[model samples]
Target: MKKLIIFCFAITLFSCNSSAQKTEQKTFEVSKTDAEWKAQLSEMAYYVLREAGTERPFTSPLNKNYKKGVYVCEACDTPLFKSEHKFDSGSGWPSFDREIKGNVAFGSDNKLGYSRDEEHCATCGGHLGHVFNDGPRDTTGKRHCINGVALKFIPKE
Candidate 1:
């Protein structure tokens, strides 16, 4: 009985250690400054990407863009969306069925006197856009309405 109890305690300790290691492994570090971001991105891109401002819809070339590529954050260069996830929502903005894992953080948006979930970059906290429930259920059942100026698409090879 003592041997069995010791074995159980060892297993628990191993499990806890593994779990702690996994948590540590999942943590990511963000290292960038305003000067670096400004130097790397245009003024408009910096406004939308660093200041969390929304760009005017129907004005982004990405809305009508059909290129196959990964859309990365304009400020941080973090991969945010894939071309396969993009779709025409006709909402005068670029829409995506889903986002790259851990790329966006969702929050309650009370802006415009309405309640909606806003999607922002997880890395830089830049407002990429908002999310809607009205989308193709066959996919992720989500409409990630994004600002085209906030993203830079790298065409697939």
Candidate 2:
């Protein structure tokens, strides 16, 4: 009957709007409001870190960086990865063989119509990027494909 059809439609709408399938992020030690974060981060950094946006490939200067240093979260300055793990995955973005364990957290991202492991700064819960198993077989074999704008490089002394 008409009532049955309406109920079904309402259920579908609610299901689609629900985020039950997505992994939940924990409370970060460093949290900020939208306006506060926007004020500190550059336009692109804010987009990628705060808004969960990705930057254009091969456009980040950090992508070509080969210096010795550590990569920190642009949002909260939490160290995420080291230059030692940096590798050329040819994925356009800055790829890493592994993350500095305990500094980054993983979650499920089904945004692109498929499931991908999403990475974020553990301290601030800012969106970093995704992780894959297609990295160097010699290393940890994890391709932490990160948005360059999400990181700020600190050179080794």
Candidate 3:
């Protein structure tokens, strides 16, 4: 009886520590060294794009931007979200209902003690932000709460 309990406990322990859920390392089209990234991006941009850090809400000037243009990845210039897809989610972050297909990637994020759908730039694997379900129902019901520091707006000509 004691041996059975010990065996079960060992199995549970090992199962919890299993690497089955470990995310695979992905290769991007654009890769650079840490130093190169730091040199190319601003301090805040580097934090949000490279380190997955979040900026203070309402701090990004892009949050209220309404001009017609495309928002691109600050690190790789990959077109991410279009201005038309952006909306005032009131989440303080620049919220988008959709992304330019294949330009953005999704991954699991459990940083906040809960699982979230994390978004990233497919071109350079730069962390953008997380996507939630609470969005405008008329369109794609996804609120891509992105860190504005991770994006660079290019006005339409």
Instruction: RMSD for all candidates, in order, please.
Output: 9.6, 3.2, 2.2
TM-score of structure candidate 3: 0.89
Tell me which residue pairs clash in candidate 3: none
After aligning candidate 1 to the native by TM-score, how far in Å is the CA of 8 from where it should be? 56
Q: How does candidate 3 score on lDDT? A: 0.95
**111-141 per-residue lDDT for model 3 (tens digits):** 9999999999999999999999999999999
- Arrange candidates by TM-score, highest first: which order? 3, 2, 1
The number of the candidate with the highest TM-score is 3
Per-residue lDDT of model 2, residues 48-104, tens digit only = 888789999999999989999999999888899999999998988999998998999
Best by lDDT: 3
Query: Candidate 2, residue 97: CA error in Å?
Result: 0.8
Report lDDT (CA) for all predictions. Answer: 0.85, 0.92, 0.95
Instruction: Please provide TM-scores, in order, for all candidate models, with all chains considered together.
Output: 0.74, 0.85, 0.89
Pairs in steric clash, model 2: none
93-137 per-residue lDDT for model 1 (tens digits): 899999999988777777689899988788877778899999879
Instruction: Give stretches of model 3 more than 4 Å off.
Output: 1-17, 21-23
